[model samples]
Target: MLVDDAVALVPSIPGRRALLGLAGAPAAGKSTLARRLVAGVNDRLGAGTAAYVPMDGFHLSNAQLDRLRLRDRKGAPETFDVDGYVALLGRLRSERTRPVYAPDFDRRLDEPVAAGLVVPAGTALVVTEGNYLADDGPGWGQVRDLLDELWYVETPRRLRERRLLRRHVRGGRTEAEARAFIASSERLNARRVELTRPFCTRVVSPRDP
Candidate 1:
């Protein structure tokens, strides 16, 4: 189904901001889909009517990872600052008149860029995508409650793996390293992410109808 179609269904709250979340496994294309939904809604509504805030911005810095001995598995849920992300989302919903800044993850540097994205005061919808948005753990369950709607982007395993391989290679991994990562960390994380599917408001596959 077209992402634009999904955007059409987002009901506007009278005074509070509406939040739409897209959750999926690594390389499942959640971010790309989230952007499309945001653009589609804005196109039909009005410019500056929607904004995109990604959870990747909450990724722990390499320094922090090194200190925590989690450098080897940087993308794992434990590697992120969930509390910080949750707080930001809370602020976005409560502080409607002020600007809320969100961080963006830089793949080239494998780090987060501070205040890379801004959700303006009048934004009607905020589209946030990430692997753990629907996670049911203590620090994560709040995410599901904050979102007005959550769509889980599901991709075929093979296709998802291929996209991940390419992304890893582009991010400076060799073919062998990429394959090893997929076989180990990424695969494990993907499995965990899929378990949160039942918590989503809807499942959005490439073949969504």
Candidate 2:
């Protein structure tokens, strides 16, 4: 989805609770767009006014998932530590002092590292980007309650799948294996995300112009 629309939508926020959310499927470039938006916002507003916190950090540890025998569904909603993520969002929204610690997901290891992230106070806007940020479930609604507005990044399913497949291949999966995983795993999640698209304040479609 278009970055400028997402950016423009952020300022209309009701005020004080200056949090924005970006939601989409995996490899939809949600994180990349979040970075660009932060840079653009900070470029105009000066430093430290904008920050990004992602939901991927709340993934349950591989070990923990292994214990639960849910490791195969890593990207599924139930696979994440949803409660912990909600708590962190609450803290960030309130601008917690004394460094609120958060888990950080290490892609190389495919696990979450505890207390590896700290969000200090004075961050005027917390732009969170994640696949489940717009989910309609009770766990995800907690994030919605803390945000002033939310936007969904809209991309063609074919293009999204192409990008995700390439990303999986680059991340070490064989081409055939990557395609199969995306078809079965990523496709399911994308469909779920599409269902929740209506919850977004706006839908953004990026153009090359």
Q: In order, what lDDT does every prediction score?
A: 0.87, 0.75
Q: Which stretches of candidate 2 lie over 4 Å from their true place?
A: 1-17, 206-209
Task: For candidate 2, write residues 82-182 as lDDT tens digits.
Answer: 89888888777665344567777777777778877665565566778888987877687677777778878888888888898887787778999888888
Q: Assess candidate 1 and give its lDDT.
A: 0.87
Name the TM-score of candidate 2.
0.87
Per-residue error (Å), model 1, residue 4: 5.3
Error of 1 at 167 (Å): 0.8
Best by TM-score: 1
TM-score of each: 0.94, 0.87
**Candidate 1, 1-209: lDDT as tens digits:** 55566566555665678788889999898878777777878878888888889999999999999999998787899999999999998888777788898899999999999999898888878888899999987699889888878888999899999999999999999999999989989999999999999989888874543
Return the lDDT, model 2, position 51.
76
